[model samples]
Target: MKEIAIAGAGPMGLLLAIRLKQLGYENITLVDARAGTYTRPGILNASIFEELTQLIGLPVDFSDSYHLKDVERSLYKIAESLNIKIMKANFTGFEGKALRVEDEHHDIHILPCDLAIDATGSRRALVNEINRLFPDAFSVQPIADPSHKKHLMAYVKVEEKTDSDPPSTPAPYGFDFMVQKLEELRAMGWKGFVEPGFYALPLAKNKTCFYVEIPENLDASQHEKWLKTVVAFHTGKDNFDYTLLPASRKYGSKPRFLTFIVDPHQVNEAFFQHAQFPCVIPVGDAQIEPDYRIGIGIKSGAYRIKCLLDAMVLEKDQEFHIDFEKYQKELAAAMQMHAAALSKFYQEKQRSYEHYANLLSIYETVIASASMSKQKELQPSFAELIQAYAQSLYDAGNNALESILTSSGDIPLDKHGLIADEKKLEDAIARLIDAYKYAQGDLYTMASLKLNEIAHLYEKLADVFIQRGAYGSSLKCYEKANMIIEKILKDRAESVLIKYKHTQTLHKASRYEDMYDMACQTLSEIKNIGMDPEEKKKFTYKLELNKALALLHILHIRKDLEERDYYEDECNKAIKHVKSSPYLKDKHLLQLTKLLGEIPIESMCNILKDGDKSDLAADKSKRR
Candidate 1:
């Protein structure tokens, strides 16, 4: 058996020991400064609990009243099921092949172990000591707050059966439960624990817990007053009822707040850099600081324990210290990925909150306007209401887009990632368009303009489609591109490049009539806009060539000789313009001249072979 000692009995530390035992690593000792196991439940998000379950090879039974219950109750159940005893008394420090701990007598007791692990939970004193003792090996920060200090939670246990099923009010149960409990407490004039920066949670029957926190350097008295007001609102009176627990007092102090926010896999980095640590390896909280939101701490701790176990079982000949460094890079990568995700979640929440506040204000105004008019007919129509909502939605989308454009640093942009988020933006735009189609207000025109802007965004989407070889979808995107181009032309008709591209897009889409009309418009626009003689001649030549092609097609389709002659005359005039142009000095111009030459030759050959030169000559002479 490989003897390993783990320090700290917090959730992460305890879980580490449990996972080690489960992996068949016997002779494991878990140490903490606390005399007994952790009794109160820690603040862990539900997602973290689910992650913990997967790491430890045990199902987390969160059906109980508390989501993150005391590790004593939860871990004990796991211990019984696995037949493992993973906990022990305090761990003072470590030496090679041994660890020291103190009993009640203040004497040090040394125990031999092959490996020592520091899983101490945010204990700055121990971290600093390690840094000092192994100057080059440890990276310790005394004032790090990985999770922002603004979060303060209160866990309260409401009195059971007091008002279990109060009247069936119109308020939602989830929203009103806390209010109802507060009312009951206020009626009782309960003077419970009142502390600054505190919130309450009801963990069990007739039991409540309060947690308080604040940002560093904040005035405690102001927070105290706020806490009193919150308690009064809850109790419906000016007091709280409950005894203050010692644990609450300990938590009330400004916490040292340290965060490892570094890459978790970099655990061995300090060791390599400093060449310290004779036998003990820091794991879990003692190893690195990870984002608290995603519960990476517990997962990383479990992973570290598993790594140690694997090394012991598979690399018995190699030293344990050397083996520990091998897994540090992997841990660092996992830590970085989790931290980045947590940062993104934080930013998104900030944006969503601002948007929600704006929407709430608009909704209030609509409600107020409806109330002011005595006549129900004076109220805004349903279409008007939807239009307002859709506009707000579009504005929120614009804010999100702005966020994306201005976002700094690296962000994930692969498929099913940030790109999927952009797709959601497209869906938002489509919904806005649908809203405009049904809206009766004058604002629909404004909405249409917004849709034009959205269509422009399709340029980015089109690039994505082209890369994926969805040519059919690419074609539809090009049509939308043309629609935007047309709108721009209507607004800025003098823009030559815009007009030119508009015609090109039409031709690409195979809209012959629209393309022909654009060519004629360009011809008139060049002369009317007062272009130089050379520029005008260039435009006239291209327009005449386009007209000649259009007329040739018309001639092929016409059955009547009179209509054919008319188209033939149009072609003749167009060919004359091309022949008289000074720009026909290049190979491309030579090619055009050659192709146009074939047209008259083919017509003449038909007339001569049929012995109808007199008729053809009469037709040509009439045109002349």
Candidate 2:
């Protein structure tokens, strides 16, 4: 590559700059237009950061506990040390292979480069403009606006640590204070503007990161003033202090992060041919920014850039082409997975928030009480420890739930795993249930809702389990789901209908007794429900059919002399019921009649064959 120009110097952009330099591309220019801030304010996945750094042959060593700013700043500094020319210019749009950039002095220039990286966050400034100019480049509109807006971001900077020594837990006290304040802000207009609450990440040992809704029509001064008010409100007491970082104001509206993808067909062809768009590849939020709720923006950007870099390196021997097409498709799929997970993760967060807060509240209460106690050593009961432990699990589960999704929406496994992910879901369900036990009142209600969701998830997991031939685990999942669903639906018609399905499943597995028992119970439940008489009668008839089918299965299983009598009697009874029924389907009645008639002829043949053998025996004896 003769010359490559990259737009934006966030973590992804910075990393791509470093990668290009490592690969020894002669002329490379890295540009950071958005106020030249080293990083966007968000959580960074430190694990992947390490891998990417290693891939680029960069020596950045630290624990996997860095924030967005740390990564971007480090990458930017590394790029500079490698003699990569960095520019602070705003990218207005593109002029063919030439990039149009506006400098700080407001002077515009068309700088030509072989390739350009669009790491311009969610704005996708050049991507949008390029598509407008080249309508045939993509299949459809690439940007997706979220209908249900929950894109509230907050930045929490701690003034000082309680002590110089770092805390043992990854969770910072600032985050705890942030959460508790969110709990209080529900009385304010915070809930109206945000999700149930804000999620917090520590930028440093002393600094925590959060996001919020910036009120409408606020000027720069007013915005800063408002942010200060919010900071004070959250850190007024309990030794928590913070400073709100300025919100990212693009256009007039504070849009939730928009999701984008190049058209699938075009993206798939990016590697083989020198497509026009690869020269202007979009990475990070510019490509597809998932909801803050899903929280994959940082990782998503890193993955896209890494894939591009690898593709370039692999094919470096032959030519200058990169696997941009495959990179875009995989990246798009990853983004969609996050979007799919948003609804479920958001709901779980809402339902489980109370218990999460209560646990924290209880912890503070215990600590405070212990400090005031006369005994030097004070300890909580076994029950209290269990309660806290369970609560912690639920909190972790809620966060992890975002990873479980499949293309067909049937299977649920972690998105990042090489194989089916069971433990993530299993641990979540187990811990949630454990926490649900001690829940009371509002906590109890929320837990019930969450349990219902877990039940649904379990049903999906059971399908995957059965497909994998883990029938024992499948059955256990089914039982758990059935139990939770039954309690939720009670004696309602829906429950009866679900029970009918259970009977069908049992029949499929040849569990005849279980099928018959379930069918009878469902039949009785239908009769007891106060649904319309016609509705009840219809459901009851279906259950009777299921019961008869189970009986036929039972007869087939038996080898005794009584098998025939029992089979005949059950068939006759079922046949009679079919004829008497008002709404019995015609096909079912005809099948029953045909089966009933065959039984008699089969029985006669059995008896006559035995008599013939006996007569032959008698004749032989006389001869002897």
Per-model TM-score on C-alpha atoms? 0.50, 0.46
What residue runs in model 2 are displaced by over 4 Å at the alpha carbon? 1-3, 34-53, 60-70, 134-184, 192-278, 290-300, 313-319, 323-624
Please write out the lDDT profile of model 2 over residues 427-539, one tens digit for every residue. Answer: 66565665576654555566667767667666766666667766656666677677766655555555665576667667667788888788877876776777778878777
Clashes of each: 26, 5
lDDT for model 2 comes to 0.57
lDDT of 1 by residue, 81-193 (tens): 66554435566665545667765567676766765667675553344456667674555532232223444344444433454421112222222233334334333332221
List the global CA lDDT of all models. Answer: 0.50, 0.57
> Candidate 2: TM-score?
0.46
| The candidate that achieves the highest lDDT relative to the unseen native structure | 2
